[model samples]
Target: MLMTSEWAIILDEVDELSNMILSSEQAHSLRHAYTAVYKDEELAVEIAAFQRMKDHYEDVQRFGKYHPDYHTIMKKIREQKRALDLNERVAALKIAENDYQDLLDEVSLLIGRSVSDAVKVPVSNPFFASSGSCGTGCGTGGGCSCSS
Candidate 1:
C-alpha cells in the first residue's frame, strides 16, 4: 500500500463533511425528537408492554397457535404495537429520522455519482438507482470469454 497526496486530501474533505453533518441543524432536530420520544411517559409504557407481549408472542408463534397463551399473546402484541405506532411522539421521531436520513443519502449519492456512474450508493429513494452491479453471471454455458 502507498499513501498518495490525493487520497490524503480526499480523506480530509470526508472528515470535514462528517463534522459538518454531525453539527448540522437536522442532526440536532433528530436528536431532540428522539430524546422527546424516548422520555415520553406514554410511549415508554407502550414500548415496554409491546416488547413483553412480542416476546411471548414469538414463543407462542413457535407452537403454531396450539400454545395455551397463543391467542391472548397475539392480541396483546397487536394492541400494543398499534398504540406505539399511532403515537404522536413516535410520528415526530420518524419524520426527524427520515429528514436526517435523506440528508445523508443525498450527500452519499452526490459523492458516488461524482466519482463514477458505476458507483452504487444505497438510498431510500428508488429513482436514483445507479448503474453497474456486484456481478455478471458467467455468460451462456462456458464458451464465453471476457476481454481483458
Candidate 2:
C-alpha cells in the first residue's frame, strides 16, 4: 500500500518508538524474564504448579469429567501465574514492554485508519481518485486522461 506523507511521518515515529523500546535494557529484561524466572528453583516451582493445573484442566475438559477440585485448581493456577508476573524486576520490565507495545499499536492503527480513509474514494470518481497533477497522459502513452 502507498502511504501518504502524513501516514509516512506517523510510521516513522512508530518505528523510532519501537527502536527505543527494543534498545533499552528493560526490554531485554522483559523478553528474557520468563526464562530467567524458570531457571530459578523458587520461581520455577510456581510455573510448574501453574502448568500442572493447566494440564489438569485440559484433562478434565477432554474427558468431560466433573472434577470436584477444578475450581480450586484454577484458582491456584491463577495465583501462581500472578506471582510469576509480579516478580519485582520482571513486573516493572513487563509493564514497560506492554505500555510501549500499546503505544506502537495505537500509532499503527492511526496510520492504518488514515490510509483507509484516503483510499475510500471510488475508482470511477476521477475528481477524488486522481491527484490531477499528472503532466503526461497517465504515464502510459495516452491511456487514461487522469492519473488513475
lDDT of each: 0.75, 0.60
Top-lDDT candidate index: 1
Instruction: Give the Å error, residue 125, model 2.
Output: 37
> Which 10-residue window of candidate 2 scores lowest in summed lDDT?
119-128
Q: Write the per-residue lDDT of candidate 1 for residues 52-107, one digit (tens) a residue.
A: 77888888999977899888887788877778778888888889898898788778
62-144: candidate 2 lDDT, tens digit per residue: 64536777677667767777777778755765675665555544444445456763332222223323443232224565365
